[model samples]
Target: MIKKSMLVEKITRRTIGFVLTMLILSIGVFYLSRLAPGDPLQSFYGDAIESMSTEELDAARIRLGLDSPVYVQYVKWISNAFQGDFGLSLKYKMPAMAVITPLIGNTLILGGIAYILVFALATLLALFCAMHEDTLIDRIICKVGTAAYYIPPFWLGVVLVLIFSVNLGLLPSSGAYSVGKSDDILNRIQHMILPLVVMILSHLWYYAYMIRNKLLDEIRKDYVLLAKAKGCTKTEIVLKHCFRNVAPTIVNIMAISIPHVLSGTYIAEAVFNYPGIGALSVQSAKYHDYNLLMLTVLITGVLVIASSIIAQSVNEVIDPRIKLMEESP
Candidate 1:
């Protein structure tokens, strides 16, 4: 009963924290939008703003609620947003959601595939390095992982495109899909390869290095030595003892990485012209479309919070001691 109560309390606190975070983020974005230079009307009228009469400009201001005080406009916007209305995009002249919805799927596809590949390869390589510790293979992988982690993703992406798409003519350089061609799954996969590779290479080394250090620490613990004294093989010790003990730290690292991964995807998508939220965000900024930008920021905030909640929940399941420790004081 006490454990159950503790679990509920932890969940309640996390839920409250999530709500507070969203509120603060929304308010920040709201004010930042107002502070940004440039007339929102320019997105609609361009240089024609100079030709419009005073009455016409005022009418446009009133239409967009820009005529009101900033706080009043913020209140109206927050109220409307709660009801699922995010306003029209100043650039596209469509509802903000209409502009954002289709691009989300493309981002999820690119981000999701890259995330899985990175974690899988990182884990395997970390394990390999951990078991071999200080040997030639371990030293080589550490050097490689360090180099890969430090290389900028965009620069690496450009290099990959030059080599694979331009010089070798092996893959398409830009865009998510071939225009006017059938959108087959294989064709989509082909276009996805370069971005996916970029994402993985950018992240894989850092995670592997992190995991290797974590596993090494775990292997030094008394429990691991006890298992070794009981005749456990090196492989058995790593798999059964070190990995299990390090899992929570790994989960925490992954949780924190979720936002970075999304940001990286944005850059990668823009470079590849992948038509994902990242590319859309770039276009939105170019055209001064704050409604779309605000929505994207809100979505990113939610994702970060959600990832934290997931990591906390997984930690509780894998090591209930964490909950007890928090509850103790």
Candidate 2:
């Protein structure tokens, strides 16, 4: 009963912290959007408005409600955003959601597949390295993973494009799928191959290294030694004992990787012209489209904070030491 009450209290506190972080991040995003130079409306108008007088510009500003005070504008934007409205995109001249939702779908498709693939491969590779620690296989895996880790995704995408698309004609150089092609599973999978490969190559290394190090650390612990002394098989010791003990650390790394996944995909999206959230964000930022840019960032911020909170909570679950420490006082 005491543990249950404590858990509830901890959850409540974490919820409050998450909400506070979200509020601060939202305010920062709001203010930074205001501080950026150039008008979003101007991106819509461009130099085509050179002949327009100040009166015309002011009139246009009023029409867009850009003439309002910053605070009033923010309040209105926030209120509308909460109701599933993010205003019209100056670039697309459509509802912001119309422009963003499809991009988000593309991004999730890419990122979700990449994250799962990279994580699974990294886990296996890291386990292999851990099992063969100090062997030739371990050394080779370490060197290769490290090398791949240092290679940027964009450069890797270019190389893949040259080899697979240009030379062998095995893959398309750009586009999520062939234009006007139906959204068939096979077509989507074919499009995913390049970006997925790029992602796995660019991302798997770090996780491999981290997991390998974690496994090595776990193997050295006194509990692991005791398990070995108790006649546990090698596989049992490694999987049931070591992996379980290191689960929290691995999960923490994954949580940290969430934000990086978003940032990393930007280069991949740009290289392949994948039309994901990363590409949309890049376009929005370049064009100074406040609505889309701010909305994207706001979503990213929420995800980051929420992921962190979740990771912390999960970590506590995997490692009772965290709960004990929290309960200490």
Candidate 3:
């Protein structure tokens, strides 16, 4: 009964946290976007804004609800948002959510694949380096990974385009799909390759290095000492004891990595011209598309916050001590 109560309390706290985060994110993005130097009228009315008289401009402002005070605007927005109405995209001239519905999938595809591959490869790379220790291979990996991690993702992306897309003519350089092949799975994969290369190369080593260090730290613990005194080999202790205990730390790393990997994913989209939320965000910001921009930022914020919560839950499962500690008197 106590366990159930603790579980309920945890869920309640997490749920409240998620709601508050979205509220703060929405307010920040909304206020900042409005305060930024730009005529949102230009976004909605395009060149028509240039020709409008004062009366017409005021009418336009009134029509779009931009004539109100900032707080009043926010209140209206938040109230409508709760009812599943996010308003029309000023630039796109459609419901903001409608504009996002299609493009989000591409981002998910790129981000999901990159997220899985990065963690999986990082773990394997960490394990290899951990097992190798101070060998020549380990030193080489450390140097190469550090260098790769430091290279700006956009510049690396450009170079990849020059090599494989321009010089060798091997891969599609931009866009999520070739013209008239939206549903072609193989073609979609081809488009994803270069962006994936950028995303993975940018992030692969950062997590790997951290995990490698964590594994090494775990290897030095008292339990590992006990295992060693029991005649366990280095490999046996690392695989059986060290790595097992480090699973919670690895989960934590993965949780915090959402934002890191997401930034890389956005960079990949912008560089590759992928028709994902990243590219859309760039467009929205450039055009001062207020509704579209807010929705996009909120979506991104939710992913990051939710990942942390999910990681906490996973850690509770992997190491029950986490739950007991949090729930203790």
Best by TM-score: 3
lDDT of prediction 2 = 0.84
Q: Model 1 compared with the native: what TM-score? A: 0.94
lDDT, candidate 1, 62-175, per-residue tens:
997889988898788888899999988988899999999988888888988887888889999999999999999899888888888889899999999999999999999987
Question: Judged by lDDT, which candidate is best?
Answer: 3
- The Cα error of candidate 2 at residue 139, in Å, is 0.7
Candidate 2 wrong stretches, greater than 4 Å: 1-8
lDDT (0 to 1) per candidate:
0.87, 0.84, 0.93
**C-alpha lDDT of candidate 3 relative to the true structure:** 0.93
Question: For model 3, what is the error of residue 185's alpha carbon versus the real structure, in angstroms, after optimal superposition?
Answer: 0.9
Which residue pairs in candidate 2 collide?
Answer: none
Worst 10 residues of 3 by lDDT: 2-11
Tens digits of per-residue lDDT for model 2 on 199-277? 8888888888889899999888898788888999767888988988889988888888988877777778888888787
Can you rank all candidates by TM-score, best first? Answer: 3, 1, 2
Per-residue lDDT of 9 in model 3: 83
